[model samples]
Structures are given as structure tokens and as C-alpha cells.
Target chain A: MAELNRLWEKRRTDNFQMQLRYWNLIGKNSGLMFVLYAMIIIGGFYYKRWLDGLPEHFPGLLLISVVLSALSVRAPVRTFIQKADQVFLLPVEPELGGYFRSSRIYSFLVQSFVILVAWIVCMPLFFQMAGRNPVAYFLVLAAAFIVKGWNIDCRWQEQSIDDLIPLKILRGAISFLFLYSVTARLFIAVPAACLLIMLLSGAFLFHRQAARGLLKWDRVLDMENKQAMKFLRFANLFTDVPQLKHRIRARKLISSWFPVRSFDREHVYDQIFVKTFLRADDYFGIFARLTIIGMLVSYFIGNGFYTVFIVAATVYLTGLQLLALWKHPLPQALAGMYPVSFGLKRRSFVRLLFALLVIQTVALSAAGAAGMKSPAGFFAFLAAGLVAGGLFSLGYTARRIAKENR
Target chain B: MDPVLSVEHLTGGYSRQRPVLHDVTFDMNPGELVGLVGLNGAGKSTTIKHILGLLDPFEGEIRVAGRTIRQDRLGYRQKLAYVPELPELYEQMTLEEHLQLTAMAYHIDRTTFKERSGRLLKLFRMEKKRHWFPSHFSKGMRQKVMIMCAFLVRPDLYIVDEPFVGLDPIGIQSLLDLMEEMKKQGAAILMSTHILSTAEQYCDKFIILHDGQIAVQGTLEMIKQKFGDSRASLHDIYLAVARGETKWLN
Candidate 1:
């Protein structure tokens, strides 16, 4: 409907304003950007070396990563684009075609950027194994990219791969064969024959899926687009990008923390912090993600006290970073006038922060120590986690006090 | 009854160098509904901010329940509840969670919190939607959530900035009735609004602020007497004060 399209446009405009506001608050931190680009370049180089042995695996891996990335991009980007004023634009639904097209195109480009880099890195490895036949490789790469673009667009329409399973399986197989045969450095005729078979198989699958579906592509596209938008909201926290609120049904597990009985202010504050951290995406997401990363590193890198130390540091950093926003901008109106005593409020907040740090550290350190078979390392890491958490809490309190006094 | 809120020689702004309100002073006694009138960028919010202790007074002091925040931070703050012009409920928090948090922050007992929260939720007709997050709420619903949170604790003073902007007619009536009931209990209200007709009907006193200073302050009859214009309405007086009408001043 015309109304829905208008709503989408208005939402986009409002989201742009919010993004600008956030950026203004935190001036462009170019250092973080530089570090990210540097990592990408470095990772590209590392992958190139790693692919020297099993060159056939590179294309398949790149294909999987690209598809997954495209699917994941929708959630955060959509959430970012949704504005509070979107209700006003609700009537312009008929014009949503333009908006959806532009969104899909933009998402495809972003999704492709990383894939292109990965492709470039793996290309050399393929050539080295298959002999430097640039023409054949370029032709295949071009075809693959075209298929990929279409695949992303299709995915955006269909959403889950289950909706078009045959197409997905066919695409996966073709991509697999394309990488496997070509990079195996087989005979030129063999690759040429394989490419022809893949082309026919993909064309058949596309036609089959395209024929069976009588439903409007736009409607499907809208649903897929919304699904993407939801994921984007969750992703925004990681990259300071826009996203929709990833609507997740909260699991009804351990619902015991309600209507806290502790009359003491400290206990009440603790319950508030604990309940929020335990249930919400924002707090637990950071804790879970950082700890997972630490566990991965320890698992792959060989574990010890060093592993526990790194996990502790990560857990502490996660708690500190997550709580940083709340401590700033001084809810100026409510901050000064709240019923609770300043000293008591600060103490409760610090205690809450400490509790969060303890949970995160204990979970990660225990996992790290379990991997390392070191109780001593666990104790050491726990101490380090506590100290780091305490210092971080103190720093926040000091900042608040200083701001108030000033 | 004692004055619930008093501002003396207040001057402050979002920034220190550029003051929005200059030498502004007024008082609101218990059970009085005082409308704070101002044009766009007339420093209504700035003055309210100073009163809430969000911004420090560059040249004055604000007292809620007869105690300045600086002198007795907790006691000063405990007497007032502020409903901002825009609802800023935590998007992640459910309506009930928001009420619970407010109750906890004010240290209300469990029994009192339950009773107050239930009554407020029903008053706003949001009892069924108590478990819903602000994310799922409409503009009016979000505003209702904010109103519920502000009223959950029976503070001596209620400072509401633009409370009627997003409400339905019934919601507006509900809010007015709630304020009326609170007033009967000797609570003081300092509400800022551009909605003249509503304020004119409901407010017992008016403080017309122009260019960050009090242009005039008093009950309707008192203001009419001072301006020597019994025929003029609150809107007329507001416009006269805002435009700095030479004749009215004379």
C-alpha cells in the first residue's frame, strides 16, 4: 500500500537523524576504523597462506561465508533503518518497491565487499594449484558473483533456505564442484566440463523454484526484509550501526527473580541489575560473546594460565564497556532528584557492577581453567577478574562524582 | 501549607557560557497546579531542568519541599517526580518492569509497590499491557507508561513538561483527574505547556516565562489586577507578556 511505503521512508529519515546524533556524541574514532581495516588486510594475507595446501577448499568456504553474511546482514540493517516516526509513513505501502530494491542492493554490496576480499586472497592459491590460467578463473569468478547476487536477492525474498531447499542444495553443490575441480589444478577440459554441468544444474533449479511459486515476489520480499531488519538490530550493538530490535521470545527459564523481597536499597538495586543482566540481550550478549571468543581462542591456541588471564581480561572489559553508556550523559533530571541517597546509590551500582563482573569472569575463567587443567590458574584469574571489575566500578563512580561536583 | 517548590534567582542553560533562563524565580505551594507558559525556545525546559537539578544554577538555588538539592540531595530529590516532555522509558523494559524499577528506586515496600502499580496501571487503562515492552507500545501507550512511573511514588511535587502531547482524549482526562486527586492530597504540580486552553481551565496559578525570565506570575485574578486587564484571557496575557507589549507593561 502507498501508506506502508511512506511509513518506511519516514522511518529511514528518523533513523538517519538518530544515527547522526549518536555519531555527534562520540566523534569519529578513526583509530578503531584503522584497526578494523588493518585486521581485514592482515586476515586476507593469512588466509592466502593457509589455502596454499588445500586450494580447492577456498571457494567453498568463501561461498558459505558470503551466503551466511548476507542472511545475517538483514537483521541489523533493518533495525537501524526503522524509525520511531515510521507510523506516519504507514500509508505509503504501494511505493515500498523502490525502498526494498534499494535496501536489497545496498545489502548485497556490503555483503559482497568482504566476499570480494576473500575471493581475491583465495584466487592466488587457486591459480598456483591450477596453473596461472587467468581467463578461465576470471570467467568462473564473474559467473559466481552474478549467481551470488541473485542468490542474496532470492534469500531476501524467501528468508529461510527451507522455503527453497532444492535451490539452496543445488547452489551449494555447484559452488562446491566449481571450487573443488578448478582449484585441484585438474586438466582444462575437466574444469570446462564441470562448469557446463554446474551452469545447467543451477539454471534448472532456479527455473523449478521460480515456476512453482505463484505468490507475489514483493510480499515475500517484504517478509524477508523484515526478518533481516530484526537481525540488524542485534548486530548494531557490535558495530555502532543501525538495526531493528531483534524480537526474540524470551525463554521461560528460571523465572524466580521477580518482585524482589529485599527491603534494603542495596539488595533491591542488586536484584534490578541481576534481573536485567540475566534476561536482556544487551547485557548478556556482551558477556556471552566475549566469553565465547575467549573459549575459542583457548581451545584453538592451547590452554594454560595465560588463557585464563586473557579470558578474565575479556570478561572485565566486557562488563566495563557494556556499563559505560549508562554511567554517562547523567540522566540530569532524575539523577539529582531521585529519592535514594547519592552515596547509597553509588555503592549499590558498584556492587551490581561487581556482581556482573564476577559472573562473567567465573564462567569464562572456569571454562578456560577446565581446558587448561589448572585450579591455581582459575584462582589467579578469579582474583584478577575481581580486581579489574572493582577498579572499573570505582572509575565510573569517580567520574559521576566529578561531573556532579563540577 | 509550605511551598512545595521554590526557585530563587535562577539562571542556567545546557551550556555554562550561554544562559537560557536569567534571574528566574517563582514558588509553588502545596495543592497548586501552576502552568509554566513559554513560547518555543522560551527556556521552559531549561528552567525545569534547573529545578530538577539536571543543570546547575549559575546564579541561584532551587528548593523542592523547602530543601535545595545541593544542601540535602536525597531529601530534596525525594519530594518530586518529573515526567519529561518526551517519554524515555527503557525500550527493553516491560511496563510492569518500569513501574517496579521506579518503586525500587524510591524504596517503596513490596506491598505498597504492588498496590500503587496496580492502581496506576488500571487508571491509565494499561493493566492488560503491563507485560508489554515499550518497544511494542504506541506513542500514547509509551507516554502512559511514563505517567504511571512518575505517579507510582507519591512525591510531594510533580513536575510534568508537555504531558498532553500524545494522549487520547480519555487519556488526557485520566491524567487531569489523577493530577486533581494528587492535588487534593496536597501535592504541588509545576507543569509546562503551550496548551493554553487546558492550562487556563485547570491551573490555579500561572507563571508566564519570556526570554528565560518571569514576565508575570500570580493567580488569574491577581495577574488581571496587576496587568489592569480583567477582560483579557490567559492567552492574551501570555501573548502580551511574550511580545513585551508596551501598553501592558505601562
Candidate 2:
């Protein structure tokens, strides 16, 4: 039992460390952060001006209350129970009450941030529309905390029951109504609705506890796994998470472009590489998305030099990311046993990267030429892209691989 | 004729400073099946890694079909097919795609690849799952995919590690039959497994490893005579060897 508590603590610590690492990486990307902060600041200035000159019949209170209530209604409790807990911890189930209670408290504290952020975002509008009363604002905050706590309890109970959709909708509706009443300062309706909600939630909790003493271990573990995977997926965007397994779909329509065919021994890896890049979501999806974004940015920029630069940068990033695919076969023993030379793997990767870059360059140059309405611009962009692709695929990538190997 | 695989005084691991396998040496003859048995952390996998050229040998050398990885890297590797302890597969590749890739890598002719893959898939009862990705497979199914891929190559040597762990009984039977068929066609195999009963039944010889060294290596009769216990089962012999109880024989 003590070990279980330690496990929970460790899970939290590890999650914190992972989040910290990624957050630091994100913070270090100064250009991206600068753009994000600029957008936020610019957006915020216009938003405040818009709020200051708002229409009188905006139903601001109703809108704010409903959104806040909806946000507050989803308070998931992270139990941190893993798949192995079913086998190892099932025998000690009765002694797990304290552990679950602690988990619930931890969940409430972690999830409180959502409620806090929602309230803060709504604060300016509330002051502008509802006439700036700190007492009323504090009351709303207290009421939101109470409602969020109730929702957490209800959701935990809901996990044990089958066919909970109707109950969930009912709870959501009631929460919206209660929040509306409180926010609107309907004194009589507020006390009455609060008491009714409390009574209803208490009864529901009692009924649920009596109906089932056993926690749904499978559901709890599944939810924990999903939550962990969500964190891992987020982390994976910045760096490779070896434990993370990306979901794969056949995407037959996309894969049809690269038909698999028998190749001689020298190009066997080339055939596999092409097939893998076309079929795998990680490689192909990234390539497509980056290429599309590059085209869009190039089209919008209109200046030939800027478009060329954007295309070059996009191609470089795409090539860098695709390097991971080169190491993919390393993890698979059977793939490693392929009689192909290490140099062949590098050649195949460079060939794929060069081909993809060429396609991107051609598309971006065409888009850039159309935007700028200059044949000379198209030729210039095309030359720049080809040079960038050649330099990156042939020189930079090969050097990177060599340095790593050495 | 030269043995298909020969590891002479091979010592290696992931790191150069600390060698996990110390002076490990063994050989597998053509048309032979040798079971490499060991407890966990006893260097069964390390030895396999050395043969597969994933790790550089810290000392000595390994040769496949009389060619060292240095002398003829591609030729050395092309002669062997490996199935690892865990089924390491591309999550994105379907069963059919895995087969296609393996066939291409081994340079199997199109008709031969089609014929071999079809027979292997049906033998493992995985024909219905030809389009299923690794994500959709159970452990047994994934193991079967590895088995199918290895069998598709029909190489001169097969290096299998703990293949029986996740396989169904029928899958195991199919694998055994395929190995036997390959052996009869003059292919050699080095299989690492803890399942003493299956190894005893199928293997022509055994290499019992302890603390990274070959503790004992021979036919059942020869091993029993060396241990001065003519009636000992392979399981008994393995347990005794793992616990260092056969010091007298050593």
C-alpha cells in the first residue's frame, strides 16, 4: 500500500519532469514564442476595445456563465493506476480507500487550473458588462469551486456506472442553470438552486457508493493510460518519445501513389523506404503537413526572396525530421539483419529526402510565381529551392550522420 | 565443409569498457539446429547481438558462411535471418508489407517470395490478418509475423531468440516444422530459448551458457556423460548449470 503511494508520487514527479523539459524546449524557440506573444498582445488590445464598445443586448452574463459551467463540468480524476495494477494491486483492494481519496484530492488540485483560467479570461467581460463588483466576482469564484468539486465527485461515480450519458447531460444542464442564477444575482433562485444541487449530488453519490463497492479497475487504468499517452504525444512533438507508439491507419488513397514493387538487392531498402514514408502516418503526415504549410506561407508572402527562404527553411525542417525514419529500422532486429550496407540506408534516405524536397520546391516555386506574377521569380525560387535541397540532403544530412556515427 | 557460423573468443556488449559476454565461442554446422540455453542476463542476447553485427566484438571474431562481417559484410548478413526475443515491428507496416519488405531485403525472386510467404502465412493461420498492422496484432500474432518474415528469407542460417514465449501451440509447431524443413535443406539455426522441453525435443545439440561463458555444449548423451549423470533431463542439466551446481563437470 505504501509502495502504491510511492508509485503515485513517482508518476507525478516524472510527469512534471517531462513537462518541464518540453516547456523549456518550447521557451528556447525564441522566434516562435515572439510570434505567439505578439499575436496574443495584438489580439488582446483589439478584444478589450471591442468589449469597451460592446452592444447593450449581448447576453454577456448568460454566455460567460454557460461557458464557465461547461468548462467546470469536466473534472477528471487521474488515479495513476496502471495496467499492471490490476494484477498486483487487486488483492489489496480494500486497503486502497486512502490511496483513492488522495488521488481524488490531487486530481481536484491539478484540474483547478482550468477553472481558474476560465474565470480569469471571463473577468474583463464580467467587469465591463456586470458593472464591476468585487464581492459578486468573489462569490462567483467560490460558487465555481464548489460546482467543480461536485462535478469531480459525480464524474468519479459516473465512471462506475454503465449508460451514464443521460445522467451527464442532466448534470451539465443543472450546473449551467445554477451558474446562470448565481451570475445573474438572482438572490432567491441562487440559494434554492444551490440547496437542490447539493441534495441531488449527495443522493447520487450515496446511490453510486451503495450500488458498487468495487472500483472499475479496467476503466480507471484505461483512462490513466490515455491521459499518459496524451502527455507523451505532446512531448513527442518536440522530441522523440521511444515509448510512444503512433496510431497507424492504412490511408490506402494516400499510399496508392507509391505502389510497392520488387526491386533488385541494391534498391531493396529504397523500395521499403518509399513504402514506409508513404504509408506511415508519422513520416508521411509530417511531410505533407510541412509541405502544405510551406506552400501556403510562400503563397502569402508574395516576395520571391522571402518565399524562397520560407520554402528553404520548411524543406530543411522536413528533411531533418525525416532523418528519424532512417533510424527506425535500427529498433527492429529483423530489419537490421537485412544484408544491405549502412551506406545504402543513408543513400536511400537522401534519395527520398531529395525527391520530397524537389516536389516541395516545385510546388512552392509555382505558388510563388503565381503570387508574384513573374516568370523570373519562379526560376529564381526554383533554383534556390534546388540548391537548398541539394545542400541539405547531400551535405548537411550526410555530415550529421557521419558525426553521430563517429 | 566449413560451419555456417563460427564465433571464436567473442567478447562484446553495448559498451566497450564493460563486456557482458566474455570470450564466448560456439559454432553451428550446416544442416544443424543448436539450442543456446541460458538464464536471463546470462549473455544469450549479447551473443546473438554480436553475430547480427549490431555491436562490435570487443575481442576475437564471428563468421557466417566463412565470411567475417568485415571481409564481406553484406554476404555475411545475407546468409542469415534473425528473429529477436521481442517482436520488434514497424507499427505502420501491415503483415503483408512486412513480408514484402523482408522478401525484397533478402532479394528473393518474386514468384518464390509469393509462394513462400503464402505458405508460411497460411501455416501460421495468419492469412486473414494479411492487412492488419502491428497495432492490431496480439503478441502471438506479432511473433507469428516475425516467424513468417524469417521463414520467407530461407537463408543459410536462422538466429532466433526466445521465439516460443508469445507463440500459440500451433504457431510453435509450425515454427518447429519450418526449422526442420530448413535444416533438411542444409540451413543451420542458433535458437536461444528457456523452454528446455521444446529445445530438448527439437535441437540436435545444446549450448548451456552461464555468466556469459559456454558452461556446457554437446549432444544430450555427451552432456550427460560429461556431467557423470546419464539419466539427467535437459531441464535438470540447465538448472544445475545455471545454479553453478555442475562445477565438477566444468
Give lDDT: candidate 1, residue B61.
86
Docking verdict class for candidate 1: incorrect
Chain A TM-score, prediction 1? 0.52
The 0-to-1 C-alpha lDDT of every candidate, in the order given, reads: 0.68, 0.82
True-vs-predicted CA distance for residue A365, candidate 1, Å: 5.3
RMSD of each: 9.1, 4.3
DockQ (Cα-based) for each candidate = 0.23, 0.53
Residue-wise C-alpha lDDT for candidate 2, range B1-250, written one tens digit per residue? 9999999999888888888888888889999999999999999999998899888998999999888988887898889889988898877677887888787788888889879888998999999998887888999898898888888988899999999987889999999999999999999999999898999999999998898888989899899888888888999988988787977575
| Candidate 2, A1-406: lDDT as tens digits | 7876787788778878877888888778787789899998998899899898999988989988988888778767788887788999899887877677777788787777788888888899888878979789877887787778777777777666776777788778777777887888887767576658666765765345536755688888887788778877776766666666455667878676665665466676676677677765478778888888888888889887788788778878888878877766433576677877777777787888888889988998888888888988888889888988999988888777766551
lDDT of 2: 0.82
Model 1, A1-406: lDDT tens per residue? 5555565567667766775665553445666568878999998788766765564534553444344334332321232233332454345534555666666665567656656665665566556655678886665555455545655555544432236666566555555555444444457776576567655654555545544554344345465467555445634644544233233334336435445565555554455455555555445666677768866665455456567567657865786666743443323333344566655655666666766667777776676667767777677767777777767666754465446532
Clash pairs, model 2 backbone: none
Q: How would you encode candidate 1's per-residue C-alpha lDDT over B48-133 as one tens digit per residue? A: 88888877888988888778888887677777898988877654456776777677778888899889888888888898997777
